[model samples]
Each structure stands twice: as C-alpha cells, then as structure tokens.
Target: MAEVVGPRLYSCCHCRNHVALHDDVISKAFQGRHGRAFLFSHALNIMVGPKEDRQLMTGLHTVADVDCSDCRGVLGWKYERANEETQKYKEGKFILENLNIVKENW
Candidate 1:
C-alpha cells in the first residue's frame, strides 16, 4: 500500500474528474513512454480508449491510450499485453504522472 498522507486524491488535469485514490499510487518515478518518466500503478479508474499494436524487441505488444473519463484528455498509456510470456508482468499496468494528482485541502 502507498503511504496514506491524508485526504489526497487523484484526478484528471483537464476535467478534474476523479481518477484514483491517493493510496492507489504505486510509483511516481516510473520510467516509461518515449523514455520519459511517469507514474506507474495498477489499473486506474480512467477510461481506456482504442488499442494500437506496437512492435517491440521482445515481440508485438498492444497498448491503449488512457484518458480522463470526463474531459477525455490524454493521461497515459495502459500496457495491455505483449506476445512474449516473459513480458506478462506489464499486463494491465498504467503509466501516469504526478500532474494527475489532485491535491486536497490540508
């Protein structure tokens, strides 16, 4: 479980719609998406759009762009699965950023 720091919430930047709870945050330093760093967590509350096939060194992978359920702003990508069994660990993983965090009243 992530450190519960009191009333902190996560939401979409554009629409401010609730995305996930603060404790759901897995890592804020996950490196992904065009070699840039982002947040990593389990299946988020965001809506997953159409999936696009991507070719990887390991094998073919499928990823869907996740967006805010309300405003439809692009937040991050969801790693659906890869053709290789060794890459199964990335299945159903989300990569977002700290910007998506909605700070609550302290």
Candidate 2:
C-alpha cells in the first residue's frame, strides 16, 4: 500500500491557487483505488491534445512535444479510454494534484 502524502507545494499560475486535499478525502480515494484485484491510473500525457496550443499570431499557433505535463496545454490523461496499466497508476494520485481543474483560468 502506498502512503498518502500531501503535496509539498502545488501552484497553478493560470489559476493562482495553491491548496491541499483533505486527509479524509485523500484516504478514501486512495483505498478505493489501491488494490490487487484491479487498478487504474491517470498520467501526464504531454503529447498532442486539445489543450496544448498557443496563438503565435492572428492566424498561427504553436505546440511542442515534451514530457512536461503542464506544457502550455498538456493536461492529464483520461483513464477509461486509456489502457489498464495506466488506470492502475491513476489511483495513486488525486485529480486536483495532477491537473488544474478547479483553479482560475489565468
């Protein structure tokens, strides 16, 4: 069983929000996902996606291929459509910890 440690520090530049998850919620979510019977996980796919893009000019945009989960629009991955192993890893981390979901759109 992996220990549920709080995030040391997480800040969303776009949203300007930094907070941690409640221990109770973290514990519950962890237990529900941590098991040998079945496992699912979410990962930082810094590849091509809808979120990763920037306007270079009026009619131009740019996107890069890097492992930076926060590279412009490199949001996280979805578990259901993803493979089994990926889903398993998704269990270990919280959604908020992985991406900026509830933060402001800075």
Candidate 3:
C-alpha cells in the first residue's frame, strides 16, 4: 500500500468536480524499452498528459501524465517501459495517440 500524500485540488475531467488526490505517484519512462510506463493509481483514474508534454515520449510524461486535482500540475508518473506495471495497465485501457506531431519522439 502507498500513501495518498495529502489532499490535492483536482477538477474531475469526468465530473468536473474537484476531487482529492489519492494514491498518485510520480510517473516517467525509460530508455531502450519496448512499451510505455505510468504511475498508476489503484483508484482507476486514467491520467495522461497535456498535449504539449505529450511530445516527449521518453521522459516521465512521455509514458504518462499525472495531474493534480485541478489539472494544473503533474504530481506523479513513470518514465520507463519495463516498469513492471505494464501488465496491470494492459488489463485496463490505455491509449497513446500517434499524431506524429514531429515523429522520432516515440
């Protein structure tokens, strides 16, 4: 089990209601890995990233994005591919957009 750290401000993208931050972890990606990584939550909240940072697919945000309660800040993420958590995410639904905004990032 992990600590929720503390209550944070988050406007639910689903409900648009400010929610509390719980089980949020720092996320990022690793080099030379095959798949993406993410700082997952046991609460089943799908967190991606701002379109701006989405360009970077090798750093933490490259793998995933963890927003604050208000979508104002990135609180946590995973930056590697062999994160050991991919299997867990596979059971659910995770989508990575290949806009090819600039290519070479992914």
Candidate 4:
C-alpha cells in the first residue's frame, strides 16, 4: 500500500518543469477532448494556446491545449470558457495527466 506523504511534488517529465502539488489534483482519471484521458488539477504551470470551441457533456466550453512551458510538450488543456455555471469552476483550470510526471524523493 502506498503511504500518504504530506504534499507530493510533481514536475514535467520532459523538461522537469514544476507542475503542481498533489494536493491540487482533483481527478486521477478524466476523459478530455477527443476522448483523450487526463489527470485533472485545480492549478498547473502550463502554456495554453490555440483556443477552440468544444461541446462538453456539461455544456459548451471554450478550451485550449496546455503544453509544457519548457519542452512545449502537449500536457493537457485549459478551460477558457464554459456555461455560466460551469465557468465559475472550470475557467482557468488545467489537466496534465497525459504528460509524464517525474517521481523523485524530495
């Protein structure tokens, strides 16, 4: 069994860019754009670009792909806009499960 450490630190596997703390991880598995899977987090240090409009199960959402700041690898995406209700929580949120996370002893 895995032990529960304080706060797990995460970094981009490619460029070793600091991503977020495990405490911010909201979902371990999430289905994203084009049926892609991802790890959801409340906060992430990523670059979002090429905004696009997408229809989600909850509602219409304007999102953009988020990439690693250093390596420019496709990490996940950002929710730029959403319905009035969804926007309150979805906006500015990010996902980075597709990208590799560096596991190290801190």
The model with the greatest lDDT is 4
The digit string of per-residue lDDT tens for model 2 on 6-74 reads: 443333334434433233123223221112111113223333343233332222223232223443542
* Pairs with steric clashes in candidate 4: 39-97
The runs of at least 3 residues in candidate 2 whose Cα sits more than 4 Å from the true structure, single-residue gaps closed, are: 1-7, 19-82, 85-87, 91-106
Tens-digit per-residue lDDT, 16-100, candidate 4: 7877776766666566554434445554667779999887667788889878778887766788888768455767777665436
lDDT of 1 by residue, 10-69 (tens): 667677776665565666656544443344555355789888997754578798888887
Position 69, candidate 4: lDDT: 79
Alpha-carbon RMSD, each predicted model:
4.9, 14.6, 12.9, 4.0
Clash totals for all candidate models: 1, 11, 19, 1
Ranking by TM-score: 4, 1, 3, 2
Q: List candidate 3 segments past 4 Å from native.
A: 1-40, 43-47, 50-62, 69-71, 78-106
**Model 4 alpha-carbon miss at residue 79, Å:** 0.7
Could you say which candidate leads in TM-score? 4
Model with the higher lDDT, candidate 2 or 4: 4
In model 1, which regions exceed 4 Å deviation?
A: 1-6, 32-45, 55-60, 84-86, 99-102
lDDT against true structure, model 3? 0.33
User: lDDT for each of the candidates?
Assistant: 0.67, 0.30, 0.33, 0.69
TM-score list, all predictions: 0.66, 0.22, 0.25, 0.68
